[model samples]
Target chain A: MQDARIRLFSFVSLSIATFLSVPGAVLSLGWLLLSPGTLRETMKSAAFWVILLFVTIIATATQMSGNDGLSYFIRTGVIILLGFSVYREWHPGEYLDLSVWLFGKKAGFDIGLAVEMSIQGLHEASREFARIRSALSLKGLQPGIRLIPAVGFLMIHTRLMRARDQADLLATRGYRAGGSCCPVFRTSNRDITMGILAILVVFLSFMPVRDIFILQM
Target chain B: MKLSLSAVEWNAGSWKFRADETFTPGVHLVSGRVGSGKTTLALLSARLLQPDAGAVEYEDIRSRTLSFQYPEYHITGSTLHEEAESYGVNPSAACARAGLAGRWDEDPFRLSRGELKLFQLSCLFMRQWDLLILDEPFSALDCRGKLAVCRSIGENRSGIVLVSTHEQHILPKTDYLWEMRTGKLTFRGPLPEAITAWESAPGPVRMLREQGVIPANLTRDDILEAVCRMHE
Candidate 1:
C-alpha cells in the first residue's frame, strides 16, 4: 500500500510537470522559430527546429502509443489552463496569484489535492535547490552553479523523498506545508467526448457560428 | 586567429581574474590563491561561466564543448549508462574505463564520490573536443588518477587545456606556467626558463621569489645544474 501510494504520487507529479512543460516548450520554441531570415537563412535556422521536432516526435509517439489518450489530454488541458491563468489574469506577474486562486477564493490551503500539489511542486523545487546549494557550499567548492542542473538534481531528490514519506502523512492526517490530499481523477468516456466537443466549440466559436449569430442579430 | 585575453573578468561576486599574457591552449597552468578566480578563469575559457569583463576569443573557428570539474554536477541521467548516453560519449570499453559496467542500470547518484568522478572522467576522455577546461579535477582522486588526468591534459590532443588547479604536485612537464596574483595573472614562459632566470638571480632577489613561482618540473637539481658551471 505504501509503495502504491508513492507510485501514485510519483506518477501524478511526473505527469503534471511533463504536461505543463509541453506548452511552455512549444511557445518558447515558436518565438525562436519566428526569427527574421532569408530563404537560405531559414534553412540554417531549421537546424534548431529539427532538434525541437525530433523531441516533439518522440513525445507524441510515446503519448499516442500509450492507451491513456484521454487522461493525457486532461492532464495537458489542466496545465494549459493553469499556464493561461498565470499569464492572462496576472498579465505580467505570472503565477503570482495562482496560490490564492488555487483554493477557489473560499476554502483553506488543501481544497483539492492537485491544486495543493501544484503549489507544493514549486515550493519543493525551490527548497531542494536551497538545500543542495547549502550542501555544496559546506563542501567548499564555491563555483558558479548552473540553474538547470541544480534544479534538476534537487527536483529528483525532492520527488523521491516525498514519494517515500507521503504515506506517513496520509496515515497521520497532519497538515504539513506540503499538504497531502487525493488527486481528483474524474475520467469517463462521455467526459472525454464532451472535452473534445468543447474544444471544437471554442474553435467554431471563432468562425461561422459567431458570424451567423451576428447576421441574425 | 590568436585571441589574447587582456585585462580581468569579474561577475556575480567579489572575485576577479587577470591574465598576464595571451593564451594559446596547449598546457597552461592557472595557479592562484584559494579565493582567487582560478576556477572562474577556467570557466571563462570553457565558456561555461560568462565574464562581466574581458573576452575569450577563438581567433578563427569556435569551440563547441566546455568541461566542468565536479563530475557529479555533469551527471544528467538516472543510471550510469544513461549519464554516458546524455553526453553522446561512447567509451571503447565503458565498463572497464569508467568502472561502471556492473553498475550500468544502478542510480548514478547512489555511487560513491570516487566512482562518480571516474564515470565522468571517462566520458570526457572519450570525447573529441577543442577546449577542455577542467577546474581542479584532482579534488577527490588518488595519485594514479592525478597522473592519468595530467597525461590526458598534456597530450598532443590539438585542443587547448586550461587546468584550474592548486595541486601542482602531479602535473606533467608543462609548456607554460601561469599564476594569478592581486587580480592580475602572469604567464611565465616554460618551467625551464622560469627556473633558469630564478637561478641566475642574486641570493637576496632569489629569496623574494614565492614558492609558487618555481613549478615542480624544475627540480632543485636542475636549477643547481643551471646555476653551476658544467661544461664538457
Candidate 2:
C-alpha cells in the first residue's frame, strides 16, 4: 500500500466487487476486518453506530418487506466498512502523487490539488466542530437541537472565508489550474500482489459462484 | 490566582511549542507574530488542548473561558435574544450592551461579522470565569468595539486573563507579558521589563524607549502620558 497507484487500483477493484455482488461485498468486509485495529477503531466511534442505526431505521421504514430491509442494512454496512478500510490506508498526499504519476502533470496536478483541498476542508470542519462544542460548554450550554442552526451558519461562514484565503494564497503563489510535479512511487511486491488479487476478485464476483458450486455437487 | 505551565510541549501540524512559566493574577498579554503558537498557548491555558508533554496547572481557579480568534465559532444560540441570554444574563440588557438591543428577535447569523463578535464578547463578559483566554479578540471589531473590549478586560479584577494577540498597540493595561517566538516562550516577565527586554518590541514602544521616555506601565494611556510629558 506504499504506492498510491496500487492502493488506488485495489480500492477501485474492491468497490466494484462490493457494488456488483452481495457475496463479494460480504467477502470484502471480512477481508477488511483482517487489517489490525480496524474493528476496534470503528467500534469506538459513537457516530458510526448512530449513523448505522439511522440508516437501519430508514431502510426498515421504506422497505417492502423484512427481507428487503435486511438486505439494505447488510449492503450499507458492508459499503461503510469498505470505505473505512480504504480511508485508513490512504493518506491525502498520496492521491496527489498517484494522480501526477498516472496523468500528464498539468491535469494530474489540478485533480491532486482539488483532492488535497477537500481533505484539508474536512480536517478544518472537524476542528471547528470541537471548538464550537468547547464554546458551548464554557457558556453552560449543551449542544442541543436549537444550537444546530447557529453552528451550521458559523461553520459555513468560516469555511467560505478559509476558501477565499486559500484562493488568494494559490493566486499569489502563481498557481494555475494545472501544474507539474515529478511523480515518485515506492510500491512493494506485496502491493503488486494485492492489486492483482483485487482485480481477480472483481472478475470472479461477476461469475455465478453459487450456481457453479451447486452444479459440481 | 495563578496558572502555570510546567515544561509544556505541544505540536499542531508543523509547529511545535514549548513553555515552562507561571502566570499570576491580572492581564497577561501574550504577543507574537502570526503562526508563532500564540493561539496554541491560549488553547493550552484554557485546557481545550492538552500538551503532548508536560502539564498546565491552575491554582485556586476552577472555571475558564476561551474565546477563539473567530467569534462565530463561539456562538451557540439561534437568535440574538437567545445568544444574549445564553450566559444567564438579562436578554435585553445583554443585547443593549452588545449594541444589538432592538435586533433581539433577529437570527444571529443575519448580523454582520463585527456585530456577531460584539455579541459574543458581551456574553463572555457576563459570566464569571477564573481564567479568561481571548485569542485575537481585537480582530473584526471597530474602534469603539475594541475600546469597549479593552475596558471590560481592564475592569475585570477577579480572574487571570490571558490575551494572545499580534496587536501590540491598543492592548489593555497588562500586568505581565509573555512573547512566543519560533514556537518557544522567548520572553516572560513584567510588562515594562518585557518592553525593555524584547529585542523586537513593537514600533511605538521602541520609539518611546529610544527617546528616553520609559512609561510607568504598558498601556495606551500610560505610554501617551509619558510621550506628552517628554514633549512638555
Candidate 3:
C-alpha cells in the first residue's frame, strides 16, 4: 500500500486474522502474493528461512506430542511473509508518519524516532556483518561457531557506539523531546481495495469450517 | 610476484565494473572520482569479490589483505591491544606506532575515527603482504597521519601495493599510476610520464601540468621541485 496508515492498518488486521485460523493465513498469503515481488524476495532472504527452520523444529517437537503444530507453522509462516512484504514496501519515514498521525506529537514522535533508529541500526548491522565476514576471511579465519562471540561482540559494540554518537549529534543539533512535524499520507484506490480485502479475510477466519464451506458452495 | 585482473567484470544492479590490468611490485596509486569503483577493484583484487566474467589471478603471491575504507569495519577487537593482536602484531608496539601509546586497554571503538584509522593502518602495515590493497588509506587521517601512511608506503618498496585514494595532496612517491574512468580501469602507466596523461590528476598536479611542468612523481616534494625548475 502506498499509504503508510492503510498499510500498517492492513498489516495489523491481517496478522490478527492469520493468527485466528488456518483459513485466515491461507487468505492472507494469497493476498500477499498479489504484491509484485514479495514471494521472491521473502524466499531469497536467508534470515527468513533460518527463522522458518527454527520454527519448524519447534513445530515438529509439538507434532511429536500429537498436537496441531501444522496449523501453528502455517500461521507463523504467513505472518512472516506478511511482515516481509511490509518491510519491502517500507520507506524511511513511513513509521514516523503513521505514529505521529495515530498518537499525539510528543509520545508518537518519540516512539516513531526510536523505531526509525532501530530499523536504521538493523540495516547498518547487516552491512557490518558482511564487512566483518570479509575481514575474518582476510585474516585466514573461517566463520564458525567458535567465532560467533567475537563477531557478535564487534557488531553489538559498533551499534552501541553508533547510537551514542547519534544521540550526541541530535543534542548538538538542538534536538529535544517533542519536535514539530506534520505527517502527510498519500493513498491509492488499490491500497483501499487491498485493505478491505484484509478485513474480509478476518471475517472469513471467524466463520465455522462447515459454514465457510457452505458459503463457498 | 604478480597480481592480474583478466577481463574481470562485476555487475551490481545497473552499475557495471570492468578491469583488466596487472600489478607487479612497488606501489601502484589508483586514483578516481568518488563512486568510481576503486573499492570494488580493491575487493576484487583481494579475492573478496568474484568477478562476473574473467578472473583475478595471482602468481607467486601468497599473503594478501585489504584495508577497508571505514576503519571501524576492521574492529574485531574490544581493546586496542586485542585489535593489534588480531592482526598478529605486537599490541603495545602497534599502539605506540599509531600514536595511541598507553591506550592498549582502551576500547578500539572509543578512539576517534582518525585514530582508529591510523591504528588499523598501522597494524596492517606491520605485516608484509604480497598484495596489500588499501582503499582510501588517507581518509579520516590528519596531515600527520597521512604523512605517516605515505612514509609507510614509501618504506614498503616491495610487493604490489594498490593504494586507491583521492587525497588532493601529501601522497607517497608512487611507482605506477592507474585511474578508474566510469567503471573501466585504465592504466596510466609509470609515474613520471603518467603524470601528464593523468586526467584526474589532483588539483596541484593539474595546475603544474597546465603550466607545462610535469612532476617527477605525485608527491609534495616532487611538485615543488617541478615548480622550481619551471621558475628557472
lDDT winner among the candidates? 3
lDDT of 2 by residue, A105-132 (tens): 8888898888878877976887888888
Clashing residue pairs, candidate 3? none
lDDT of 1 by residue, B1-232 (tens): 2435655466543555665356664666666667666766765564545556766666653543444555555655577776667666663355457656677787877877677777776667676556666677777877777766666665634666666666735554466667766566666566546544432333422443433233235323443443443231
Scoring model 2 with DockQ, what do you get?
0.61
Interface RMSD of each candidate, angstroms, one decimal = 8.8, 1.6, 1.6
Docking class of 3: medium
Error of 3 at B16 (Å): 4.3
Please give the range of 10 consecutive residues that has the lowest summed lDDT in model 3 chain A.
Answer: A208-217
The candidates, ranked best first by DockQ, are: 2, 3, 1
The Cα error of candidate 1 at residue A156, in Å, is 6.1
Residue pairs in steric clash, candidate 1? Answer: B1-B59, B18-B185, B20-B185
lDDT of 1 by residue, A7-126 (tens): 223234333443544433233223223322322233443333554455556557767897544444444543333332222212111222233334443342334444445566655665
Off by over 4 Å in 3: A104-107, A180-197, A209-217, B1-24, B51-55, B77-81, B91-96, B100-111, B181-184, B197-199
Model number with the top TM-score: 3
For candidate 3, write residues B156-176 as lDDT tens digits.
Answer: 769889999989988999999
* Deviation (Å) of A57 in candidate 2: 7.6
Give the alpha carbon lDDT tens digit for every residue of A115-152 in model 3: 88888788789888988899988877788998888888
Identify the superior model by TM-score, candidate 2 or candidate 3.
Answer: 3
Indicate which candidate wins on DockQ. 2
Task: Give a tens-digit lDDT track for model 2, residues B47-81.
Answer: 87889999999999988888888877766667777
